[model samples]
Target: MSNEFALNAEARSDLGKGASRRLRRNANLVPAVIYGGDKAPQSISLLAKDLAKLLENEAAFSHVLSLNVAGANETVLIKALQRHPAKGYVLHADFQRVVAGQKLQAHVPLHFMNQETAAGVKTGGGEISHTLSEVEVSCLPKDLPEFIEVDMAKVEVGQIVHLSDLKLPKGVELVALAHGSDLAVANIHMPRVQAESEDTGTAAE
Candidate 1:
């Protein structure tokens, strides 16, 4: 939580297939773009290795990153990442430049803790199924959370966890809440034996 990775980059003027490929071959840098609000999208390049290391931590996806590019330092959040399917390498990333007071939407990673030894799993052999790993949330740059917490300690068998149930930071709003869809965030289901027992009990009555 305390460590932040900063990357140095320069604005890219020459673009397209030939320019990008040439950049990759000559500099080992990948082409990227940054945009948001009233600002126009700018072409940029980042070191592929540094980007890979950043992706290893889920926090990097949503946390405010200090991007030093084009002779300017910009505070931005990662919006999307494109990877080479076969090589599993980062090809491009989309960054949304943030203004201090403007509201921005970033996909925050979900942290699941205390689920392994929960009562549902220990006593009832419940299977922990997660429907979402990261949740999109809107908030000011300063109000952005490092990650969303899903408490499995309170999750019992047959219980469903929804985005509305999350305890978010002040001013932060989950994207799912506005949609009004009953998306299953997660569920605890009993093992086969317990399921069969309940089925037998119903059949007898």
Candidate 2:
């Protein structure tokens, strides 16, 4: 998370579908835009190979990025990415300018640990089911976490983990919990096959 991701881009004066298509097909560049903050939105293009490489790392999605556009470096967050439906190639990207001390919403991935050693899974013969893989959090850029870890070692069978149960980093807050949702994040339960087998055994007895 401490590593900085930098992409070199160029200001694109040509606008429209035709222009973008030429940029991608001819120059091997992907169309992109930078907006938000006090500055007007700027159209730009990035190398397709370079962007694909950066996206190979999962942390890039949640990490702040430094975009160097024609010698000017700007701090931004990846807001949206558009890819080809069938080919799965990145077609366009949207970058949002971030300011210091301002709270922004970003989705951080969840990392579950100790599943095999959990009381429910080890002793109670239960399965761990993850209801959510990521959650939206509201925090300043500096306080943003790359991923939230949920320890399942103490979780018991039939127990559910909710948004309120998660331990948040300082200055970070779950948007759903703040909005009174308190949604379920994960749960430990008997597998369907085991449950069915137990029911059949009881009926036979």
Candidate 3:
């Protein structure tokens, strides 16, 4: 895997809510825990500025990260993040160790292509409605993707794009679809204003 994203951290011996609060308040560090594989859970703290800069890129969430904790480098995937409700800043993070052959689940963002030029919107006077911004996929570490592409160029009005319609990369599988749920991803439909106008016209006649 490419080491495009990396973070340097210090092994944290001070654990718990109060300690984490103090670390964030006094030292501007984000407390985090790394677990998985054959190793026990490890606690670490990262520089807030460095972590914030890394998070500026959207692909970082899906990509395998190189985390250096106290001079030891480990491959990890971001599992969860806890943020301040009002400020929307990351407070705590959870990292999962990446095992070579083991399959893991990750949420990847969906990129909609040709939304303006889609058949339904360009010629049919319809608008595109997105049902999902991201999807959870299960794949090996090597097969993980940065994002899934949703093609909208050929979609017509009144047609709903479901999870089954997505073209996934090789070795990737949708977790929801595997559990027998074919969720809707997006759709092209007539605007509500147009529908309401037509309804009023019919009532007047």
| Candidate that scores best on TM-score | 3
- Distance from true position, residue 106, model 2, in Å? 0.9
Could you give me the TM-score of model 2 versus the true structure? 0.94
lDDT of 1 at 166: 78
Give TM-scores for every candidate, taking all chains together and pairing residue i with residue i: 0.89, 0.94, 0.98
TM-score of 3: 0.98
Compared with the true structure, what per-residue lDDT tens digits does model 2 show for residues 25-97? Answer: 9999999999999999999999999999999977788888989999998788888999999999999999999
Tens digits of lDDT, candidate 3, 16-69: 999999999999999999999999999999999999898999999999999999
Clashing pairs in 1: none
Candidate structures ordered by TM-score, highest first:
3, 2, 1
Residue range 69-133, candidate 1, lDDT tens digits:
86688777788878889987877788888898988888888898889887678777899999999
Top candidate when judged by lDDT against the true structure? 3
Model 2 residue pairs with clashes: none
Candidate 2 residue runs with Cα over 4 Å from true position: 1-4
